[model samples]
Each structure stands twice: as C-alpha cells, then as structure tokens.
Target chain A: MLIKYSVKTALTGLITNKSRSILTILGIVIAIAAIVLIVSIGQGAKDLILQQIQGLGSKTIVVIPGREPEGPSDFVNVFLDSLKEKDYKLLKNKNNVPGAEDIMPLVISSVKLSYFDETYQATILGGGDDEINNLMARIFDIFPDRGSFFTPQDVSSRASVIVIGDNVREELFGESINPLGEKIKINGRNFRVIGILPSKGQVSFFNFDDMVLAPYTTAQQYILGRKYFDRIIVVAKSEKVIARTVSDIEITLRSSHGITDPDKDDFFVETQADLVERVGFITNILTLFLVTIAAISLLVGGIGIMNIMLVSVTERTKEIGLRKAVGATNKDILRQFLLESVLLTAIGGIVGIALGVALSFVVSLILTYSLGLNWEFTFPLSAAALGLGVSAAVGLVFGIYPARQAAKKTPIDALRYE
Target chain B: MHLIEVKDLEKTYYIDSVQTPALRGVSFKIKEGEFVAIVGPSGSGKSTLLHVLGFLDRHTAGEYHFDGKTINDYSEEEIARVRNKEMGFIFQTFNLLPRTTVLENVKLPLLYSGVKESLWEKKARQVIDSVGLSHRLHHESSQLSGGEIQRVAIARALVNNPRIIFADEPTGNLDSKSGKVIMELIQKLNNDGHTVILITHETYTAKHAERLIRLSDGAIKEDAPVDHRLVAADHFTK
Candidate 1:
C-alpha cells in the first residue's frame, strides 16, 4: 500500500478511537512530565545552593581552628594555644606576600543590645580602623549607593561606633527612619551608628545583617577589657589567586606558631570555591535522591504505554492481516505501529515540558511572595531534551514486541478471524 | 492462450493430526477471456480452489500453471507478485477495507502493483465509475449497501486490469435485484475481454457464466457450456 494511505489511515484510526489515543498519550505525558519536573527541581536546587554559597562571602577565605589531639584535650585548650593576638596583628600589617591583598582582625563577643521596645542578644564584632578596609571587598556584594562602611580614620580614633545588620535596623528603627547616627546600647554602653549594611543575610555560620560592629580599640578599652583579637580573615586578590594565598597563609601561620608538622597545624584555610563545592556536593546528592524517586513514576508510565500498545496490537490484528494480504511488506506494518508510538510520545513530551515549566514558575512565584526570598524557576533546556528523548526511547523500546507480533501474523489466519 | 491450468491439486486440513482432505485431485483450465463459475455444495472445496488460484493459500500437493509456466516452484513472494500483477480477488463478504473511502479501496490493487499514485487515482476513478459507484466514490465500505460494496470490490478488482478477476460469491449477500446488477456487471467485464472466475453455490448466479463447472468431494464432477434453457431462464429471471 502507498505510505500516504498508511499514514492517513493510522491517523484517522486514532481519531476514530479518540479516547484510547488520548489515554495512551496521557501515559507518555506523565512520563515526560516526571522527567522534566525532576530535572527542574535538580537544577533549581543547584542554583539555590550556589546563591547561598555566594551569600556567604566572595573570594574571602575562612580559617577555622583545626581539631586537636584527643589526649591533651583537658588541659591544652589547643584552639587558644595554636594562634594568638599577634597573628591577627601580623596578617593585618603585612604586605610583602604575593596573592595576599589585605587581612583584617575580628573579635567576637556576645553582647545584649537594646532598642526601646525590643532587645536582641547578638554577636558583636569589634575590630580596627583597617576593619573598615577589611569589609571593603565583602560589602561590594550588596552593591549599594549613598552609604558605605565607616572610614579608617573613624576607626583609628578609638571611636565607639557601630554598623547594623539589615534585620537589626528594622528591629530598632522601623522602616520610617534611617538608623545612621542613632545611639544603641551594647552591654549598657552607647555607640554611634556609622552605617547600616545593605540587608545582606546570613553567611557561613554568621548573620552579618543581624549583628553590630565597633572599633577594636574601644571594644578592648570599654567592653572585654582585653587586647587579643579572635579570628583573622584574609581576602585574596581574586578567586584565581585564593589557593596560593591560602597555602602562603598556611606557611606563614605555621612558622609564626613554630609548628613543624603539617597535620598537627591548628588552623584550616579554605577558599570560597571550596565552600561552594562542598555545598554543591550535598545538593548533588539530594538531586540524585529525588530523581531516583521520579524515575519510578516514569518507569510505571512506560509500562503503561507498553500495555496500551499491546492492547492496540490485539485490536488491530485483523487489520494487520488484511494489509499483509493486500501486499503490504512486513516493514510497512512495523512502521505503522512504530509511528503511532512516536507520535504519541512526541505530543506528550511537548505538553509535559510546558506543564513542568509552568509548575516550576508557579512554585518560584509562591516562594518569592510568601517566603520573602527570590527562588528563581530555572527550566534548563537539557531537562526538556531529556524529557523528550527518554519518552521517545521508551515508546520505541516498549512498542517493539507487540509490533513484531502483529507483523508475524499470517494473512490467511488473520482473514479467517471474524 | 490458456491463462491458468490446474491438475490433481490436494489440500489437507489437519485437525490435531486427523487430516481432512479439502481438495483431492481437482483439475481445471482457463482460457483467455473465459468467464467460468465453479459451483458446489458446502465442503466441496470450491473456496479452496479459488484460494489456490489466487495464490492466497498453498496447496499441499498440486501442479498449477499460469501462462504456460508451472507455479509450483515459484517462491511465495514471487507467487504474491504474480497474484498482484495477473489476478484480482472479490470476497463473498465484499471484503473492502472498512474505514476507507471507495476511492482508497479501489486503488488498492494498483498500490500493491506499485503504479504511481497519479495514475492509480485516474484509473481507480474510471473503474469505480464503470462499476456504477462514481456517486459513492468517497463513501466508506460500511456506508455502502451490499450491492454498492460489491461494486466497489469489483472496481478494486478491475483497477489493475488483471488477466482474471476471481470472485467468491460476489453477490451472495445482496438482494436479488442487487445480485442481478452485480452479475450483469461481472458479465459485462468478461464480455469486454477480461477473464473472470467465480466460486458460488447458487445456480441462479452460476447461470450468468458462459461455462459452469460442478465440484464434488474436492474434484470437478462436471464441466460444460450452459444449456440454452438455463441461459434463457437466467435471462428471463432478471
């Protein structure tokens, strides 16, 4: 028979039994939709983790105190013994090393701050005049205008000053007025508010927007009555230079602390990429976990397609016989059934991709409005391609046996069938 | 020239190894432009003979020839090709493909013969109109009356302009008036120099054929030209 006739006949045959065709396409739709939705969720999660990692800090290295040996734990206080106040001073003052641009000292102290109606017990960071320079690279992230961090001169004057987190501003001043130059008590002592940050949120175990900043000199003189600054931060020239700078800092700290063995070192130096990769790894594991579950739904959907195609083959057995009797080649019969499957899956794949994109957009919209954080709906093209490819392959893989059975039927027996 | 020759054709149907011979030593020959009808009661192997003649089913043991060449050694595909090229079939049930238009069904034989669709279209329409189905060209087989459906089958059979058209009870399901129209159409095609072979149990239908052959127990018991009385009766009844 002519191919056009085969196509026309098969197409109208589907239309003649519209309900069955719709149900068959629905099976393919569900498979494609599951694939697309799973991949979208996976991509969305990666974006979320990347955003969170960026929120932590850009190109700034974290130097956590490394773990100490178990035996000396009771007496050693190794966190205190390995590095000291002079280490922070050295990093702050030094400039000869390559890949190292600037370092700043951070002194953390838990203090209670009270605004007229509300009080918050927040971690206070006290540092030096260079402390303002220390934050220059980090603060550039918020990318604001009209206000910046306090000046170095303001810090060197031993000024009792402050910079507030975004939430802290809301808690203390409401939305009506700027809190700059207002006085808030830190442990019952008043400090001048120099600048309010640009609402940057929590980062790597600390909420910068919710806390306070003061001059290290004044913090020692009036608050802690101590001169030793706690943690030292080093900002590299750029991300490409961070690894070498971290190693340089490692060597500098080891020599400064008189540590001979690398494993026995008391501090850990890591770049922003290291942090991103760690978080990315966790999210990747989560994506795999979620997609595996989604695969089950796709598998069931594929089986449903196979089942329906089998039923169709059974229904069309006599038709197949008739065509074969009329001089249709076996290949012709195979193409007919295979084309039916491909058409069903292709339609389903398109509809599923559209629905998945719409669903993800709705989810992101809800998150932005309700959670107050923008979670972008990311529909990656690869996800859509995967949906289409997987569904079509499923159709072919599952549509074969029944098609063969139909082709193998003899015309004599088929015609004899009532 | 003889178009078809058959001798000692045998077909055995196996019902769990209990062989029932459907054809036993059946023999016949058809000349060019011959219009012959084979009539026999049920179980007399007339349908089996048609199937064998059409290359639809293989005979268990037989010598069958077409155009002076023995077809027993022809491959199944070659037989099918010959069937497609040299002969056409009409079923008792007017075996037009359901869900297809009159045009599509009529174009079927030419499609199998690989005639270009443009030629198939023109010729199919001409044949369909010749069979008096031009008004129903686009109608599906299900929409057709029994007589109309048979004409559609005849149109399909004649589309290829085959050497012979083999019909099995072409008008059995039609009313007497419609049966007469169908028989008259077949007779007209045969008179126009197209060979035709019909397998039917009705003597009334058999009268339309110039030659009548009777089969009993898978063999031809009698073969002769129709007597004048039967021909007159056939003409007067219609």
Candidate 2:
C-alpha cells in the first residue's frame, strides 16, 4: 500500500476510537513531561549557581582551612584553624606572593545579637584591616545602604563596631528606626552598628541579607575568642594572574605552616572556574538520575501501547480480515498498525514537551517572585528532541509484536472471528 | 483453460491436535464469466470449498489452480496481488466498514491495488454508481438500509474491476424483498461478463445462477447446469 493511504487508514482507525487512543498515550505523555521538566529545571539551577559564582569575580580565589573535601563526611575539616594569623600575614606580603593584589583573613561563626528585647541569630563574617575589609566588600559586591564601613582605626584599636545586614537591621531595630551607631549586644559585649547593608538575597553560598560583618580583630578577641582564621580570601591583580596567585598563596601558606610535601598541605584553594565546573558536574549528574527515573515511566508507557495495540488488533479482527480480502498484504497491515502506534507516541511526546516547559516556567516564576531567587526559565531544546526521539523509539520497540500479530492473521479465520 | 480448477482438494482442521475434515476431496472447474453457485445445507463444507476456491484459505491436499497457476506458484506478495487484481469478495454480513462513507468503503480495495491515488475516487465513484448507490455516495454504511448496505458491498467488490467476484450468501441477512433486490444485483454483475461464484444454503436463491454444485458432508454430491433458472430481474424492479 502507498504510505499516504496507510497513514490515512491508521489515522482513521485511531480517530474512530478517540477516547482509547488518548488514554493509551497518557503514560508516554507523563513520562516525557517529567524528563523535560527535570532537564529544564536542572539547567536553570546550574545557570543560577554558575552566575552567582561568576559574581564572586573570576580573579578572586578562596583558600579554606581544610583539605579539599571529597564527600559529606569530610566537611568537618572546614572548621579547622589551619589558616592562622601568620599564614595570612605571609600571603599578604608582596614578596612572598607577588601576583596577589589583596588578601583578607576571614572568621565566620553564628552569633546571637540583641537590642533590647529583640534578638536575632545572624551569621558573622569577620575580615582583617581596612584594605582587606574593602576587598571583601568589593568581592561580595556589598555596600552599606546607610552609614559607612568601620575604618582602619576601629580595626587597630579593636573597636566594638559592626556592620549589619538588612534582615539583621530589621530584626534588631524596626524599619522606621535608624540603626546606625545604635549599640547591639553580641556575646555579652556591646557593639555599635556602624553600617546597614542593602538587602541582597543570596550570593554564592551566603545570604547577605541575614549576616553581620565586623573586623576580624574584635570578632576573634572579644566574640569568638579564637586566634586562628577560618578562611583567607585572595584577589589576583588580573584575571590572567589568578593561576599564579593561587600557586603563590599555596606555596606561602604551605611554607608558613612548615609543610614539606605538597600532599601534606593543610589548606585547599578554590577558584571561580573550579567552582563552576563542580557545579555543572553535580547538576548534570542530578539531571541524569532524574531522567533515568523518568525513563521507567516510558517503559511502562511502551507496554501500555503494546497492550492497547494488541487489544485493538483483536477487536478489529474482522476489519483486518476485510482489509486482507480487499488485497492488503501482511506488510501493509503491519505498516498501518506500526504507523498508528508511532503517531500515537509522537503526539504524546509533543504534548508532554509543551506541558513540561509550561510547568517549569511557572515553577521558575514562583521561585523568582515568592522565594526571591534569580531563577531563569530555560527551554532545554536537547531534552525536547531526546524526549521526542525516545517516545518514538518506545513506540517502535513495543509496537512491533502487536503489528506482527495483526499481520499473522489469516483472512478466513479473522473474518469468522466473533 | 478454466478460470478456476480444483481436483481432489482436501482441508482438515486440527483443533488441539485432533483431526476434523472440512473439505473431503472436492473437485470442480469454473469457466470465465460463468455464474456458478455452490449450494449446501449448514456444515456441508460448501463454505470451505468457496474459501479454497477464492484463495482465502489453503487446501492441505489438492491441485487448485487459478489462472493456470497453482497456489504455490505465486509468492505471498504475488498472491495478494492476484487477489487484489483478479478476485473480489462479498461477505454474508455485508462487511462494509462502519462509520465510513459509501465512497470510502468502495475505495478500500483500490487502496491496496496497483492503481494510482489520483484515480481511486473516480474508479470508486463509477462502481458505486453502477450499483445505483450514487445518491448515497457520502452516506455512512451504518446509516444505510440492509438492501442499501448490500449494494454498497457489491459496489466495493466491483470497484477493483476484478475478473471474478465471490458472494458468500450475499442476501443471507436481508428480508425477502431486499434479498430479491440483492440477488438481482448479483445476477446483473454476472450478465456484465464478470465470473460469479455464489454460496448459498437456499435452493431458491441458488436458482439465480446458471449452474449449481450441490455439496454435502464435506464432498460434492452433484455438479449440473440449472434447467429452470430463476431470473432475478423478473421478480424485482430497481
């Protein structure tokens, strides 16, 4: 039979039983929709993370006081105090690390802040000296919406001064009240809020809206009572010199800690490029896992198609016999049925792709408006194509047996079939 | 050479490995353009003989030749081609595809024929018109009366312009008046120089044909020409 007529016949057959056809393809539709939704959302998340990492500046490198964590269990190493004052001082020297532009020793801890009866738990970020403090501000793109950052005099004299995030300011003082120069009690010591930060939801891994910033000297001596630092942030003079600056910082830290072997180094360095790659790998793996799970539905969907096709063949036995008597060959019968199944699944795939895209877009909108994240709606074209291709393949694989069963019917027996 | 010739044809049905014979050594020869009826009571194997003659089923032990070629002489594809080009079938149930228009039902055979797509509708319309169903060309089969449905089935069988047409109790399911009309239509097809093979249990209906082959108990009891054939046109108009 001509392919055109075969398609017409198949379409007529499917259309004659519209409800059954629709119900038959439901599995395929849901499966493809899930795959598309997962891949699109995964791509969106990866893009958001990469964009945030890029916001940290390509020339900036972070040296954490731990060996590179390989898994969740190794995360405890992050709290080690390997990056101390001496190591920070060594990295700051121009002769020791020539490519370094600015280096800041970082101390991070959760602290409770209270102003009168209002109390808020806020993350504390401490940086050394005025220049280091300025570099921290530039790296995080954070500046006070009101008042100013504490000066170098405050750092040297270990003044009890603090910079508060938007949320922290809202919590300690009501929105109507001016919070600058108001003293907030922290760990039994009174610290004056010298700056109020603008609300920035999340940058990299930190939510700047819920943090408190102060000089490392006062935080370490009065608040934390620790002599060691949690991390050291380094800025390369140019993007091209980031690699050299990272090596220089590593060499200076390793020598300052009296480490001889490179494998025995107590700290690990991370550049923005490394963080982007790691994020991509993690997201890709997550997307692949979800896609695999979605494929099980496709398998079930294919079986559903096969089951429906078989039932259709049996129910239309007389029709098949009539077609045979009218001179349709076995191959023609097979082609007609196979085309019916493939067309069914391909339609499901298209509808699924549309549904998945619409759903993900709605979800991204929710994340952006309600949750206040910079979430983007992404249409994963590759996933759409793959979904379409896989659905068709599912049709072909599952449709063959039923089509063969249809083709194997002898005209006399089929015509006599009740 | 005869258009269809069979000798010592045998067909056995194996149900759960038990042998049950449907046709026992049936033999017959039909010439071109002859109107022959294989008439028998129920379970007389006349239907089985018609099935083997029409190439709708294979005879297990037989020499059955159609157009001077044995069934094995043609490949599976060639057999389908021969069936498409040379034979047409009318079932007892009319078998017009439900929910399909009269024109589309007649056009079904042409879809499987070697005819061009551009000429399918034209050929189908001509045959449907010949059956006097031109007024109901767009009507669905389910909407047609029993007599009209049979006419549509006849149109479908004639659409491919086959050399031989087989009617398996063409008027079996109709009232007497409609039956007379259908019998008249089949007789008219025979008069138009198409070879006709009719299967029927009613001797009164079998008399419409010029020759009759009586079958009983899986064998042919008699093969003879009719002395007083019933002319269907004399009894029915339109």
Candidate 3:
C-alpha cells in the first residue's frame, strides 16, 4: 500500500514540475544518444573493413615489399623494389613453400592508351599471362566479356598484346565499336587488344573497371621498364594451412634476399584472417575511446539530476512533515524520491535509444548517397541494454544524497518550515 | 488506569550555546475518552507540550506513560510505529497536501495503516462524508475554502481510528464562525467516545472542552474542569 502511494506521489511530483523535469531528463537523453551512436557507427566501420578484407578471398595471402607500411608516411615503401625476381622464384618452389598452390606477381603503373585518334589515361596492370587469367577469373571473379586471356607462351615471348577493362574500352574505342583484336598504342608503340573485360565495379575503394591488363614480362621489358614486382598474391592449398604458408613464404623470401635478422626483413606477409583481426582491433579501440568521452557527459547529467532533486527536497519540506505526521517512516520518504529520479533516467534512456536508431539511419543514408559507400545500418542490442543499465545506475548514485536529506527532516522542524 | 500519565515533563531548546527551555516540569494525566485543552499565550510552551505528547518531538527530561506503558525509552522507530497505529494530528494550518484531492488527503494515513487496498477509498469517503465535505471529495486542497480544508484535515485525523487526536490550534487560521464550527465538531467527536487534546490560546475555544489546563512560562498554571457552555446550553433546553 505504501509503495502504491509512493509511486503515485512520485508521478504527481514530476507532473507538478514539468519543465524542470524535462530539462533534467534531457541531459540523460543526450548522453545515452551519444553512447548508442558511437557504438553503432563503430560497428559499421568494422563491418566495412571486414567486408573489404573478405573480398580478397579467404584462401589468399598477400606479400608486400619494404617492411609493411604501418603509417601514412610508410606508404612510399610501395615504391621500394626490395623483393627481387629471385625471391619470387624461391617462394614458388614447392619444396620451400609446400602449402602454396599458385603464386601471381603484380606490377601496376599509370599510362595513356590510344586507339587511333582518341586516348585515355588508365591504370595498366602487369601479371603473368595464364596466371592472371586463372587468378582474376577464379579468385577475383574478373573475366573477359567477349574474348579469352593470353596464353603462358605469350608471356614467355613478351608479346605486345593487352586486355582492356569495360571503361577503358568504352573510353578509347567507343561503346559501338567491338575492341577485341583491335590495335592500341601504349608508350607510343603499337599493341594489340586481345580481350575485353566485364566491369567489376569497385572493390576495396579501387575501381577495377578503369584498368588494362598485360603480360608482366611485356610491360617490364618494353613499357615503363622495371624488373621488380610490386606485390604478390599467393593461393593457399587450404584454409587449415594458410598460417603455415605465411611463415614459409617469410623464411623463403628472407633467405633469397640474404637477410639474417628477423626484424630487418624487407617484405611483410599477411593472410586474409590477419587483416580482419587487425581491423577489428583498431575499431574496438575507437569505440572504447568514443564511449569514454561520452561517459563524461553522463557524469555531468547525473550531477544535474542531483541538483534538481535537492531543490525538490527543499520545496517539499512541508509535505514531508505532513507525511511524517501521518505515520510515514524515513524509509518511505527515501524510497519515494529514489523512485522518482530512477523513473526519470530510465525513460530518458529508452527515448535516447529510439533517437539513436533514427540518427544511425540518417548517417547510413548520407554515406550511401553522398559518398557512395556501402554503409550498413545496425542497432546493437547490447548497447541498448547497457544504456538502460547505466542510466539506472546513474540515477541511484546521484539520487541518494538528496533522498537521504529528505528522509532526515524531523517532523517538528519540517512542519515549522515556511 | 489513566489513558495518559505524565511526571515532570520537560523540553529544552538549544540555539548555538544557549539553552532555552520550551517546557519546564509540567505534569498531567487524563482518563479515556476525555476532551482536554492546553491553553496558553504565545511562547508559554503549550505547543511544545503538545508536540512532545504527540511524539513529534523528544523531551529533554520526562517520564511519560500511555495506557500504563512507559514511553520515555522508546526509540524513534518505535515512536513512529505507535504514532501510525494509535495517534493522529490536526495542525493549525490544515496541512493537507496541496496538490492532491480531498479523498486522497484523507486516505493518506490508511496507506501506512496496513489496511486492505479495497477498503482504503471506502473508509476515506465515509470519514469525509461525516465531516460534511462529501461533495468536494475530488477537489484539491488548494481549491477548498478554509472551513472545508480544516474539515478535510479532521477527516484525515479520524480515518485511522486513532486512540487519541492531538489538535494543535486546529482553528487558529480560520474565521470566528469557522472556528466555532470546528470547536463544536471536536466536542461532538469527544462525545462520540474519541479522546481529544486541543492546544490553543483562546479561552472561548477551550470552553467547549470538558477540562482545561492553562500554561504560563513553560509550566501549567491551572488544571480544572469548566462548565462546558454548549453541553450546558443543550442540557438547559432539554
């Protein structure tokens, strides 16, 4: 019976001071909304990173030369031709890396391709002839739309033949013209187009639809002449042995490069699983940092609640006296005020969650429309639950001082108060 | 046995290092179902004595007994329990909750009385009707007149069926007409077998009670029975 009375009284108290209650609850609302938004956006970024890594195919391992680029300045390390041809040969030997099924080396450069009078700037990719065909078609899912890729004999002979992407074909030869078996000029030299590639849109923020592919030996020997590979993609025999293959490639490359110190190795090897784990770790830290900053606001919100409750206690002194005179115990008065503050924060928390969900939808829409990013909308259930739990804890923690002050008022003094 | 017994009751007030005695060595007792008045000028400690009697304040020195049991050693919790079950208070200001309806104000005590939920509103309505404010059951205390507010307070004091009602200047804030009506109501309650201890400075209000105890300088000056004017006038017509 007392509990029922207390609840009714608490509700009446809130209604009696509507504007003050709303302002106090608004503090909690902003704090909880910030928490939900941070966690949701963090989860979205993690998903995007994982999706990018997955697009590389789980069975593939990547090798980069010149010490793994750890920071923005280290990106220049891609220009260092530390991984020589001998290192690639040693890694491809079955006895050295038994877990490897196939290896494909890649070299990329920007060049102008011309078909008769029209010309367009395009990224030129150089890879082994048949290896490029099988790797692009099977692993990357890129296949020629109208014609077949060149043969291994073409790569051995350093043939001046090229396969053009969908956008490159359209740009140089126009959509009406079939570019297969047409002759294109590369570095002012005549080169024949052997195939046309279907568009693969964009993967990992790079557009594969605006590039041309040629035999690695042909590009290395003739156009923008270079003898070193930029990056290598290795297909593991199976998922179970991917880790073993990573270590084996590291040892074989280090030995071929004549490196004795592990730390001084010129190349870095990474599997798809390792990339996924690294992305997840970075995103988790970002989430934690954002949440910690938001929690400071929650602390201030709790303090605001306490300030309002203290004013309420002072305003209701006469009522407290009356209640005490009519047989209400100190415990009853304490419980009444505590219930009111908890109700305030709990309701604030629920409203914050709804607002956060709506905000996340707007964020995802902006990402998709303006930036053309495939952003996913997520409402993590644990975040909502945590928001509610934290709000309740804040209410209890901040409400106690004011509530105890109310309970401590003696009936005679309270009744005498103006 | 006396319904109330007091032996040299004393209460002292301390402000900073100063000791001010509000009540000094007052003694009195009353039988069951009696209507008694404690009258005095302001600062004569009549209100202080009433508060101590109602268990709203503690006595600095005293031995008090109610219904043959000593209450001098009762803890604050024990006193609160006894007040809930046995004591009711009617304040001079008609201290009904300003935001609540008349019925809700009257039912406040029953919320602590352990009454069944189904009977709370019923009992509250019955007492409100007896006080003749049944028509204003749903009206907030702020919306009520002074007379109606005091009547609601009386109904609240009666809702728990307390053994004794401590009314500290119950009509001090009302007009003379309303004050007379409140005095008559208290007389009727006493006649209906309810113990009432009224505290006031007005002699005319005390005249309605069967007995009077006058205080001066924190001590009782006179303790005697008076010819109750209302009861006497009714007797003469009969």
How accurate locally, in lDDT, is each candidate? 0.74, 0.89, 0.85
User: In candidate 2, what are the lDDT values of residues A1-418, reduced to their tens digit?
Assistant: 8888888888898999999999999999999999999999999999999988888888889998877887636665643878788887788889999998878878999999999999999999988575544656776789888898877777778889999999998887987889988999998889999898998888877888999998888899999999998878888999999888888888888778888898777899999888898889989999999999999999999999999999999999999999989899999999989999998999989999999898999999999999888998888899999999999899889999999999999999999999
**Weakest 10 consecutive residues, lDDT, candidate 1 chain A?**
A137-146
Q: How far out, in Å, is residue A114 in model 2?
A: 3.5
Go through the candidates in order and give each one's DockQ.
0.37, 0.73, 0.63
A266-360, model 1: which lDDT tens digit per residue? 87676678778877777778767876787677677677777877888787777776565556666777777876766666777888888877777
> For candidate 3, lDDT tens digit of each residue in A1-418?
4677777888899989999999999989999989998898899889987887788789989898877777636565643698667777888889999999878777889999888889999988887734444454455567787787767877878999888888998898887887888899988888889888887766653466798888878888888688988778798999999989999998888788888898887889888888888889989999999999999999999999999999999999999998888888888889989988988888778888877777877898998789877788888677889999999889899999999999999999999999
Strongest candidate by DockQ = 2
Docking class of 2: medium
Highest-TM-score candidate: 2
Ranking by DockQ: 2, 3, 1
TM-score of chain A of each: 0.82, 0.92, 0.89
The iRMS of the candidates, in order, is 2.4, 0.8, 1.4
Which residue pairs collide in model 1, if any?
A127-A216, A165-A209
TM-score of each model, paired residue for residue: 0.84, 0.91, 0.89
CAPRI verdict on model 1?
Answer: acceptable
Docking class of 3: medium
